[model samples]
Every structure is written in C-alpha cells, then in structure tokens.
Target: MNVFPRLPDNLTGGLRRPNQVRRDQLEGAVREALSRQVAVTRPLTADPAGQAIRRANRIRRRRAGVGIALGVVTTVLIGAGMTHLSGGSDQQGPPIVVIGDPDLSAQPLATASVAPPPPPPPPSSKASADALFASALIDADGKRLALPGVGPAELAHRLPNGTGLLVVGAPTAAGRSLWVAQDDGLVQVLLAGAGQIVLAPDATQVAWRDGEDLLVAGVVGTQLIGTVRIAVPDSAQPVRFVGSSLLVRPDPTRPGHVLWRPGADKLTEVPEQDTLNVYGSLPDGRLVSQVSANSADGTCLALVDPLRATKAARTACGTRLSPDGVGGMSDDGRWLLVNGKVGSTDRSLLVDLERLGTTLDAVPVGPAVSGAVAWTSDSDVAYVDSSGWLVRLNVKRVRAGEPAEQTPVAGIEPGDRPVLVSGS
Candidate 1:
C-alpha cells in the first residue's frame, strides 16, 4: 500500500529534482527495513511457544518451552516517514518501536541487535518425544531407587528421611487408590480420589482423606498404626499438615481454610486466612499459599500467620508463586520452589520465603506448572527438566542471592516421572 500519495506536479513543480531524490532515499530505507526484519523473525532453529513452539523442540515433550524469550523482537514496517523498528515487550531491551517519519540515513537498524542463540539446551537437560519418568525415584546423590512394588509406580512425595513413600498409579486391587511404601513393599490405602498426601513435619504422623473421613495415623516402621478417622464436613479434603494438626478445606465452595486439631471434633477457620489456600506450614506456625483472590495486587506467594493473622507481607506480581502442599516447602520452612512467570514466559521460581522481596529467581522450569518437582533439602532441589534429565542444584547459592545451576545428574526415561526420594 502506498503510505504517501504521489505529490502533485504543483507541489513538486518547484522542487522536482529534490523530491525525486527524497523518494529514492525512502525506497532504499524500506528495502533495508524489510531485509533486517525478516532475519529477526525467521525461525533459524525453529522452536515453539508455552515457551509451546519454542518448547515442543526442547529435550522432551514439555508444553511450555524453556524461556529463550529474552530475545523476542517485534518489527513492523508501516511506511516511509517511519521505517526501521524492533525490541521486546515490558523489558528494557528488544522489541523497540519507531514513531513518526524521520531521517532514514541518520538512523541505524534496530535489527542489528540480534539475540544470541539459547545456551545449547542446558547441556544435559534434553528429553525426547517418547521420554517419560525414570524406573524409580532418584536421591540427592543421583541414585535411582526403584521400588519393589510391581507394575507402574509413581512416587508422589518421599517420606521423612526417605524411609518410605506415597505411590499413586492406575487401578489395582486397591481400586483407583493410594499406597504406602517402605523398603520393597506396597500397602494400599484409601483416598480413592485424591491428590498429594501430606505427612507431619516431624514424620511421626501421616494424613489423608479416605472417602469423607480424614484419617490421621502414626507412621510406625512401614505400617500406619493407631489410625484415627475423623469424618470431615461433606466435600472437605485434607491438604497439608501443621504440627500434629491437619489443614483441611471444607470443599471449594466454602469461604475460609479449615484447621482441625488432632482430637478436635470440628473444623476451625483460621482467622484472616479466610482467603488463603494453605500449601505449606512452618514449625513456628506460619503457612504458605498463593495471594488471596480478593487481592487487587494480582497473584504471587503469600504467608499466613496462624497465631497472629497480621503481618507486613511483601508482594510482587511480576513473578508468581507455583508450588502447592506436595514437595513445595523445605524442611526448615524457609525456601520454596514454585512455578511462576518471568516476564511473559513460564519458569520455576526458587523463592526464599524469608526474603520474598529479593531472592525470587525466575529460573526455567521445563513443564510450565505441570510435571513433577521434589525438594531433597532446604538448600538443594531435584526435578526432571523438559529434556528428561534429573537435575540437582545447591540451592544455598540461590537462597543467599547467588547463581545456582541445575547440575544434570541422570537421564530420565519416557513414562517415568522422577522425584527426590528423601523429599524434605
């Protein structure tokens, strides 16, 4: 389309030669912009987005690809008065824009700022189209622990000291069920339709929802002894354990989160925490959850005080908080690993709960918020990246505000979701 209508003979009559020269210069500028823009948009390596088109080509079948969005550039060629343009969004660097027509020769091509290729897929963090989980769980030392349990075995969260585990899988004699594992054996339990089962911080107690009943039992050796079943309110489910007390939700239709003490006959609503969803708890009586839905600040990680419901919380919507009650919190209740957004892409956020404002590193998590992640220690975390390699990193540097690398430990197999055996 013609951006500028042809200047009439009357307008160019007095300056035909100069106008002819100007039109030629503009034509040259448009050609140059088109070439540079093409180079920027070309899929040289041909990746997909979620970081999908970017990730579908990653080490494995990760929905959201590892974040190489650090170099996204948007170039538009409208007309002559305005020409070359590029730069990324929200961030300071790429995806820049040029408004209003200006001198073409005096300006440089923004496309000159091409981004370097994504660091060669993090060495060992590559997976295949068919890759799944490893045969068994992996420990901090990178050793695979294949359970003696027959058929399919998916470890949910490792028990205290990696002594036992909670396994879930396809239908068995136990029906669509949950199992308790120790050594090489598997004992099926109820909670037929449930999610990550949680244990007490001390590991002396275990909790789960069996039908409408919330069962609190003693973890003795491989068996659950002295089981006490407290029928929860209709539709309520057990989420995480704090001290000897269990945090239950009276179904999603309910307003506040419920905390049922060991022998309590009823659910106690945690004051001021009515809007929070408890995912982790601290020995000091604090709780972990996402920001309240009623909040105008948008979603991020938040802490709830069980004792005194008020505190000057730090909030940042730029990066989100991802983990739930599963293997989300650390042994000491200080560091947390969750899925969050780094700019416009999905990434894992290794957050130092004690320092929420500063150490929320927007690290790349292969599976956007899906897949499996387990914590091996307060300073170390393990997970199978999008590439299907089990990686362990010293979270010490990350918590202390330093750089931490996901050191590749072992390659993961297709259909095998690996978890840190000694899940803290």
Candidate 2:
C-alpha cells in the first residue's frame, strides 16, 4: 500500500482522486502489455477486407464445382437410363429389352391361328335344247315305251338333261297323276291330282296346282328332292315361273289380284288400283299386264315391278282391242308374244322388249290362230292354228318387217291341241 504515489488531496477531491489515478495507471500498463502480445502473435497476411473477399470467392468456387460434379453425375445417369430404354447396352450378349406397360407383370403374348376362307363354289352349267327335246319325245309307235305305269302321256316336258322327261296325265284315274320318265327306262310318279305344271327356267324346280293348294318340288338330275305345299287363295291359278319363283293369278271371280311365291313357303299378293290381267313375267320379276283404258273396249299394257306394284309404266299398247290375248316371253326374254285381232284377222305380234319401243306386226304363217301360242326359243315361236296344226315362226325376221317363214311341226297332228315347251 505504501509503494504507490499519492496525488494532492486538495486538487483531486481528497481520497476519490487518489483511487482514480491508481486505476488509470493500472489500465494503461495492461493496454501496453496486450498491444505487445498482439503484435508478436499476429500472422503475415493482406488486409482484413481482402482476406474476407478471397474467402467468399473460395466458397463460391467450391459450390460451383460441387454443382458441376452433381450435374455431370445426373447427365451420366440420364444417358444410361436413355440407353437402357432404347435397347442399347455395352454387354456382348443379346440385350434384354422389355415392352408394354412397366407396372404390369410380364406375360407370354398370345398368337392367333386363323384359317383362310373357303374358295368360292364353281358356277353351274345349263343344258342344251336338242338334248332336252330328245328326252321328251315318245318312240316311233307314239306309245309310252320308256316310262312304266304310264299310258299315253297327254303332255310331256323334258328336264334339263336329255335323260329325263316329265309327263302329265298318264292314262290313270281322272288323268291327274304326273310321271317322271328316265332314259334308262325308270319311271316315277311325281304327283297325283296335279294340273298346270310349270318348269323353272333353270329346270331345277317345278310347280303345279292341286285344286286350291299349290305344290312346288325340287329336282336334281332325274330324282325329285322334295315337295312343299304352299297355301294360296282358292281362286288362284298357276301361270308361269318367274325364275325359280312361281306366279299365279286369280280366277275370273277375283280379277285384280296377282300372287307369287318366292319359294314354296308363302304367297305374296300384288296390289292393284284397277283390274289388271297378268300376261307374262319378266326374268327380273316384273309383270306385263293388261290394264283397261277409259273405255271398256280398249286396253293398255303396263310394265309393273311386282315387288313395287304401285309403280306401273303404261306403254303404247293402249290401242283398241290390242293385246286381246296374252302370250309368254321367249326363252331369252327378248321377245314378248301378244295376240290381238287386227282388222277382223287374228294376228300375232312380237314385241321387241330389248328394243324398248319397237313392235313387230307378225304376218300369219299358217291358217288363222286359235289363240294357243308358245315361245320355242329366242328366235322362234310356235302357235296352234284353228285346224290344230302347230306352226313355227321366226321372230328375228318378223321383227325386221320381213315375212316370217313358217314350218309345220311334225309330231303335232290335226285335231290335236299341242302345248309347246321351249328349251332355253
């Protein structure tokens, strides 16, 4: 305590002044000692601000390098992923590649075993005319020689092949049974109580009327496949075959309606506004009918599509007494045979259906006709004269306005009415 010097008490406010001087002396000595120590421990470096800036720059460089390295790693990973997805690999063996949905379990793909469609069927062939007629005619003695259980056939129609014939009214009870005669001397009874038999154009089918019921039978070669009965109006009468279908008309009691069967199953009635008489059927299922005009004495011809019977086309055949009689179409469907009285003379006219508006006024080749007529072929027509003689007329020459040459058919004799069947 005595080693320290004291200041003047009067100038420093006594005891407080002496303590303050001692404190100031001690603080100055400590400050000098700390300055010397700091000087001896300090490192040889640049300014503090420069060092801080350099440290900040180093931090930024480290971050950028880390980012670059991370980017390189990500790029390499992406490249490897793309290569794997693209089926590219560094392995020597074949690479394993997966297709379809990744979330779905792998399955073996199903294979389809499809069979090719069957080849189309071959087209059918048609028979010749001479071959057909040869099968129909009887022997020289005019007797039913080949057909058994048949006596004196009234009407004979040849089948498509020359080996078979369809004969009607063999000398049986009521003359109603139909018989099929073959060239091999085999005979079969096709139907009983049958009338008005008609063969289809293809000769694969036949239709007939048994009183009020209509029967259709299918034929293959010389055998009858089956017969189907179709119910029709009691007044309907079978007229002709429109292809494999059958066309029928009402009797005089029911004049306007016409019925047809698509097959042997059912009948479809044709509607008519006025009284119409069906004369012939076209190959395409159209009907040629006689329609009355303003006067009762006059009539016109109309072409009607049976499927659409409401639509009818009236042609120039509306003259007085024209088409007084109805006939049939030729085998080729080119000519239509129509009969009418021209100036008190019974005349046969051939309408050229193929030529549209052309009509041929046929000259009588034989005696006056008895209204019985049939088409033998595309170019020929056969008609019965009043004397019951059959006359064959050339249709082509008649259409050209030239006189139709007529020839007498040998088998048809005088006083015997004939039914002409054409071999198409």
The top-ranked prediction according to TM-score is 2
Looking at model 2, the pairs that clash are none
Model 2 RMSD in angstroms? 26.0
RMSD of each: 33.6, 26.0
Write model 1 residue lDDT over 74-101, tens digit each, in one string: 2222332133221111122222211111
TM-score between model 2 and native: 0.56
> Alpha-carbon error at 307 in model 2, in Å?
0.5
Model 2 ranges with Cα > 4 A deviation: 1-155, 170-175, 262-266, 273-277, 319-326, 355-377, 407-414
**lDDT tens per residue, model 2, 1-424:** 7798876575655654334557788999999999999889565675888889999999999999999999999999998875653322121222121121111123321222222222212212422221223222332122212222234545556677666666666345553655565443334455555666666655577777766677776766544445666677676767666655676766655446555654436566665544456666676767776665665546666666766647465444433334434565776666766665566776666666655431222333334444435555567666655554455667656655666444444655455444444342
lDDT of each: 0.52, 0.54
